[model samples]
Target: MTIHAVIFDFGGVLFDWSPHHLYRKLISDDHERQWFLDNICTQAWNTEQDAGRSLAEGTRSLIEQHPQHEHLIQAYYDRWHEMLPGPLSDGVAILEALHQADVPLFGLTNWSAETFPYARANYPFLRCFRDIVVSGELKLIKPDAAIYHASLRQVRAHLPDIQPEEVVFIDDVAGNIEAAMALGWQGIHHVSAQRTAARLRELGVGF
Candidate 1:
């Protein structure tokens, strides 16, 4: 079936967000920085917050578990803005091009609802989407079929006739792509805007 709508994952695909952006400045030593990311403020731990745990609660709980790294734990959320510098220009260009073409656009992201306001406020490009289903707001995360279904529900509000086979889902995570594909949606594992744009063109989505 021809793809009629596009779904985007925000963090790695369109936004340049990384804890290393902040931690690199804080921890000079690469080894220690990697260690801190691995053991202390882990991806899994951060994902819990993205899945709807409050930032304050997550930070406080981690601090309690690792009292010695209280300062670092606190800094994780206290300086969270540092982790996101800006949008990826290439991806933003693609989004804008798609917008100009009047293609239906949507967002499905696993981002903390509490922190998402900052991005929504600062990033003008986010306004392009017909709707964005945030995992944090729904207390669900990527690779989970529930959140994908929720995104579909949101999309159906505007695109009542859209089918899973007619939607293209773009995500940086392979697992997220796989999940979407499982549900009969076209999937693009976005590694770069150039690649994603090329794939979109191949799928006949006009710029």
Candidate 2:
């Protein structure tokens, strides 16, 4: 089927987000930075927040578990905006191009509900998506069938006739792309704007 809609992953795909950015500023020593990320605020630990644990709840829990990192734990949520450097210009360009072409746009992301408002307030391009399914709001993360299906359902609710094959899901994460592919939605492992444009062209989405 001809691709009808585009679903984008927010952080890695459109924006550059890494705790390292914030932590690098907070913890000058690389070793200590790495240690804090691994032991105190791990990817897994952050995922809990993404999976719907309130930032306040998550931070409180972590601080309780690691009293030594209380200040740092509080910093994760307090300084959350520091982690994002802003949207990747290349991806933003593609999103604008797609929007200009009138392609139906949607977002499926695994981001903390508490922190997402900061993005909505700061980034204008996020408004390009017709609708977005946030994992934190739904308590489901990507690579899970639930989030994928939820995204599709949201799209269909409006369009009412879009097929799974008619949706192209783009993300920087391989696992999320793989999951979309398994669901019969076309998946593009976005690396750069030129590459993503080439992939979109191959799929017959006119710029």
Candidate 3:
């Protein structure tokens, strides 16, 4: 089927975000920092917040579990802004090109609702999307069919006639792309702006 719209994943794709951006300064020792990230501020733990656990609640629960690392745990969200340096310029350029071409755009991201507002305020390019389906707001996350269905609903709100096969989803995670493909949407596992752009071009997207 012909691609009619594009859905973007925020972090790692368009936005440069990583806990190491903040933890590197806090834990100068490379091994120690890696340990903290691997054990303390784990991706699985952070994904809980992305899946709708409130920052306050998740922080308090984690601190309770690891009282010794209270300060570091609190710092995860308190200084969360440090994790995001800025947008990935190359990907943003592609988005701008697609916008200029008048293709419908949407965002489907596994981001915490509380922190998403900060990103929205800082990134002016987010306005390019007609709508964004945030996982935290919906209590869902990527690699799960539910969120993709929710995203399709959001897309259909603006494009009443769009079909599942006519939309392309871009994400940095392989699992997320696989899930999208399983749901009948074209999936692009975005490694770089160049590759993503090439894939879009192959799909007959002018931009």
TM-score of every candidate relative to the true structure: 0.99, 0.97, 0.99
Q: Which stretches of candidate 2 lie over 4 Å from their true place?
A: none
Candidate 1 deviates by what RMSD? 0.6
Q: Which window of ten consecutive residues has the lowest lDDT sum in model 2?
A: 6-15
Q: Tens-digit lDDT track for model 2 on 20-108?
A: 99998889999999999999999999999999999888888899999988988899889988999888888899999999999999999
What is residue 100's positional error in candidate 3, in angstroms? 0.7
Residue by residue across 3-42, what tens digits does model 1's lDDT show? 8899999988889999999999989999999999999999
Report per-prediction Cα RMSD to one decimal: 0.6, 1.0, 0.6
Q: For residue 142, what is the lDDT in candidate 1?
A: 93
Which 10 consecutive residues of model 3 have the lowest summed lDDT?
1-10
What residue pairs clash in candidate 3, if any at all?
none
Per-residue alpha-carbon lDDT of candidate 3 for residues 1-207, written as tens digits (9 for 90 to 100): 689999999998899999999999899999999999999889999999999999999999999999999999999999999999899999999998999999999999999999999998999999999999999999999889999999999999999999999999999999999999999999999999999999999999997
The TM-score between candidate 2 and the true structure equals 0.97
C-alpha lDDT of residue 145 in model 2: 94
User: How high is the lDDT of residue 120 in model 1?
Assistant: 93
Which is the winner by TM-score between candidate 2 and candidate 3? 3
Model 2 local distance difference test score: 0.91
